[model samples]
Target: MHQLEADALTSPRAPSFIVTLYGDIVAPRGGVLWIGTLIECCAAHGLSEGLVRTAVSRLVSSGRLEGERIGRKSYYRLTDMAEEEFEAAARVLYAPPPQPTGWLVTLSEAETVSTDWLPIGPKAFIAPRRNDVLRPNAAVLSCDTVAGIGALRDFAAQAWPLAEVGAKYDAFLSVFEPILAHVWEAGAPPGPEALALRLQLVHAYRHAALVDPRLPEAALPEGWPGGRARALFVRGYLALTHAADQHIGLTFHDSRGRLATATAATELREDRLRRECLA
Candidate 1:
């Protein structure tokens, strides 16, 4: 019997954690470091004090992160070099490759189950569930086996305005298909290297796709896919969207009230299919 081992699947937290950490640093305003607020930010996201301290130290040494030590706290801000490196990373992500745009809809349905379903960050707990809090084990999954494809496809269409996003989304798919195919064929589990690639691709895709220009001075172009950076952002955005959907059975729309009703279950099948395949 063929078995799907846990290691073959991607490390669920790596991509999201890296991106989120970078985001926290970049978005700090009013003298607040969002990354410092929670223990989970460091622990669950694999941000050890040593790793972060070293990263900050190097950035400071290299002039990417600049800060003043006020009494005991070290507040870091991006230096010009840091901004360049950050934008450079973003640019590489959205860069277009020599590929066609037909694969987006196809790869949308690839599943990531059969891999370990590790939670991203600590599970959000509260007395009353917040509307924004993602449900437990509902938003994460592993593409360790073929079974994961069905779920992956379901996630893409939901997270992105597939119909609206159009060609750029398709272009994003073109790059992903080959990677997915390689993973499937190698039957190899993701070691550190493979996992790093997966994380890179996912983060780059999401930032491209979903970056809110509503954000003050969003560094990228208004609509992505117009430029190399945007394309990579969309690609990384989709990857993150797909990963989150797999890990948590997540949907931006409400899923709790109707899931129990028979009609809703029947409706869920059709709705789920829309999610799985772009067609």
Candidate 2:
């Protein structure tokens, strides 16, 4: 791993760890957590006292977190907006993706065209999930979607960068395959290292998935790697679940009930998706 990546995996100062702490721990347990609890959690990730303390202050000033003090002790909680944001993100991160039924898009016309997300020869953009058509000074047309466009295959090929997404999946697989090989051992769960490693692993894979629009398996390029990657992620996470939970129990006394609460909240989110969106 690069120095940056190695540090990210080990350090609680990383945004990824903060996200993990908020999403996996705090959000589930009702958005309120002690500053000391957060510091201790970060310490378990091998971060120093000052760095974690600074991170909490930064998050508070940025309005993503709110801090409260009682008798010289500090408590922190997710701001309402941040809690809502992370709740939505967790659904996308954990649940199966919905196939793109109707695309939301914007189009532009020009004498010359820009590079990103442009069809071959570059006329307009279909405005994929990540990329959009933003011209400097041009008339633009936008729509929810043109339902069931004909010759969809050719159009999809022109609009989205499926090959690039495939390559990202491949990269994720290559990096984690060796690490996941024995993630699930026969007997007792591994210790704190396993918890840190698993969180880092989830964060890395989640980053890859977020960048991807996650097109249907059928529409993807030949030999797409996303399926294998998701499978590995789920399987690897399951393997570490027990160990990670143990770490949580051992390290943070205040964190009790957070995981169970988070699981219930997650089920509610997933249930809504099953009824309203997936169905």
> Which number leads on lDDT?
2
Relative to the true structure, how large is the alpha-carbon lDDT of every model? 0.36, 0.60
lDDT (10s digit) by residue, model 1, range 1-279: 012322233333433444344432232222123224322234433556566566556656766556655555445555666566555444333332222211210111123321111222244211111122222433332222234444544443353343454454555555554554454566423233333344445443554444321111122123434344343334333333333323222211111111111233223333433443332
Model 1, stretches more than 4 Å misplaced? 1-20, 23-42, 70-72, 95-236, 239-279
TM-score for candidate 1: 0.31
TM-scores, one per candidate: 0.31, 0.66
Worst 10 residues of 1 by lDDT: 251-260
**What is every candidate's alpha-carbon RMSD to the true fold?**
20.8, 7.4
lDDT of 1 at 4: 30
Q: How many clashing residue pairs appear in each of the predictions shown?
A: 37, 1
